[model samples]
Target: GYLGCQDTYYVGNFKGIGKVYSQVFIDSYTRVADAKLYTDKTALTAADMLNDRVLPWYETQGIPILRILTDRGSEYKGNIEHHAFELFLSIEGIEHTTTKAYSPQTNGMCERFNKTMKQEFFDTAMRKKIYTDLDDLQLDLDIWLEHFNNERPHSGKYCYGKTPMQTFKDSKKLAVEKNNEILYLDYISDSQNLTDNQVQNL
Candidate 1:
């Protein structure tokens, strides 16, 4: 349940929107990634990215985020009691670790993914379509991200040639064993019991 996190600013403005930023999170094990665009780079936006996307997606997959690694940027580093991002992580019981100073390689997975995203998605999409608003751009980004996680085979250390989603699914049993927890078995059992009861009543 470890993830690498980073934020990147768009090199240029959109047609009418002034400036935008991208908050990205990638599973260090499976290389599954999520990103969202925001108008400004702030602790609130950083928290929002996790609150709105990252955590929910992981929860749906029955995976818990135990820790996250990020750089010592202002948006990510701050007082745990006061900063939005820090408070959010604290509330979610996630450990936050920062990269070693001046050592970008400590978080190289996120760095490489950012570069790949720019090259494979942004550069090509910008050439083909003119985005005037962040929502439209976000929609296209979501589609691209879906393809990235579910369709594209990854060469991650553990992934070999499997797609990120496949790798994530195949590794869930190991994650559960490592954490010494059942992967939502109680909830699934409850649902199954309810279905059996309904069948009996019918």
Candidate 2:
């Protein structure tokens, strides 16, 4: 599964400004991020970004995403876009799930990513007046993404003195171990259930 966020920004001072919308998709598995900057955040544009940019990037990375989880955003849930996305996921045998309305915790992974992006990239760069155009913003974003994936140490108990990439690897290993334990217990439970059923039948 993966998480996504879409938000808008405005450029220039109080007198004149132009709106730029951005959407970000982060791999919940790998913590990799794909961001698109656009003049509009409509359903068509959102779908185009996902189809052309995000999915292709995932393909290149050899990440077989089984599901995509997002909030109930109008751009994602709009009829045309939602239908197209559903069909796209269906063809890939992936499921799509949406968080309950206004429940940010359900999509907390993406929310944390968004907060980090804003704090590390947007706020810092905007404060320094570093971005003058889309190209500049894209460059800064790429640099920030590299730092985020490789250098920045994630601040979380689970991260435990490792970068996000390291944390993801460790987490996956732990998850597999935990799953195996659960499976072992489940097998025991099922065996007991079967034995009880046989005794009752006798």
Candidate 3:
């Protein structure tokens, strides 16, 4: 099951780029993460993060994002009919849960990730080069994320010192088995209901 957390971070002002933001997503179990740079923070941008990166990756892996945890920020919380983020989640059949007020631990995975990115990526990158455009910053970020997910060994409670990708691949079989078990149980239940209806017709 894909339990995930999402948060937006202020990536600071760049020379010609002005202020940039980052929409970030992290898998709670495996700590695998993805981020995209945006010029502004909005409901549409929030939804785009999942549309452009998170969901597609999960689709390739043959798993579904079961639920997502987010903060009470305007970009994340609103009416399903009017808000882009809410509507996107509704259309995708993914559950959305919000963190409790003043409870930072509720979204700790994403919070910790933001810190890591600041220290390891943004801090270093800013010192090394001047970014003139969102696309340029995004390109370098993507390269760093590739290393973060595939090369760095995560000490997350569930990762056991393996890279996020390694942990995800190692545990994917169990996730598939559990999903199959759920489907088999549902099939049995439906068959029983159908048999009861046939007997009632007699």
Candidate 4:
């Protein structure tokens, strides 16, 4: 059972966009991730990200996304009904779930990835003092994310010694095995950073 998760982070103001945001989406099962630099944060923008980037990628892979978990902020809450984000999920036949209020752990996977990006990618840019413009930042991100999704080892996230894309393919193969239940049990504890409230609900 592969699940998806998303989170947003402030990437600092750039020449073209003040308060630029990094919108990230990742596979809870595979650890494969994607990110986009956005000018602002809103439900419509998040929905657009899914429509334009995430879903299409998954579609091309012929992978079915089971759900997308997000925090309960207004950008994702969408009236708990037919908000833009929820409507998008409905149309895609994907479940829409929110992290428990006051609980960051419920959304730990994406949060952990966000922390990693800040350290490995954003901090590297800052170390080189290269906050020139959005295009430059995006180019840096492109290189970083390519390495992250394709080559980096994933041990903490139930992947013994494999890259994210490798884990994704392995997990899909695991799903068809006779002892499929073990795969679920194996990847269960990747949420150590989640809030207590989130742990309970999740």
RMSD of each: 8.7, 7.2, 2.0, 10.8
Give the alpha carbon lDDT tens digit for every residue of 56-91 in model 3: 989888888889999988999998899999999999
Clash tally, candidates in order? 0, 0, 0, 2
The regions of model 4 sitting more than 4 angstroms off are 80-82, 174-202
lDDT (tens digit, per residue) of candidate 2 on 1-202: 3333333233223212256666777666556566667666665565676787777765664444556776777665645334655556566666678788888578777777777777778777777764447766777777888788777876655565567667665666555566567668989999999999999999
Candidate 1 TM-score over all chains jointly: 0.85
Per-prediction TM-score: 0.85, 0.67, 0.92, 0.79
Residue-level lDDT for 159 in candidate 2: 65
For model 4, residues 1-202, the per-residue Cα lDDT tens digits are 4478988777777654577888889988778899988878888778888998898987776566767889987778766465888777888878888898899789888878988999998877877864757777888898999999889998865678789988877776554452345445545644443555587898
With candidate 2 superimposed using the best TM-score fit, by how many Å does residue 71's alpha carbon deviate from the native? 0.8
Ranking 1 against 4 by TM-score, winner: 1
What lDDT score is found at residue 174 in candidate 4? 57
Residue pairs in steric clash, candidate 3? none
lDDT of each: 0.85, 0.64, 0.93, 0.79
lDDT of 1 by residue, 1-202 (tens): 4554655545457777778789999998889888899888889999999999888877786668889888888889999888999999999989899998888688888888888888889999989998888899899999999999999999989899999889989998787676554446667888999999999999
Worst 10 residues of 4 by lDDT: 175-184
Give model 4's TM-score versus the native structure: 0.79
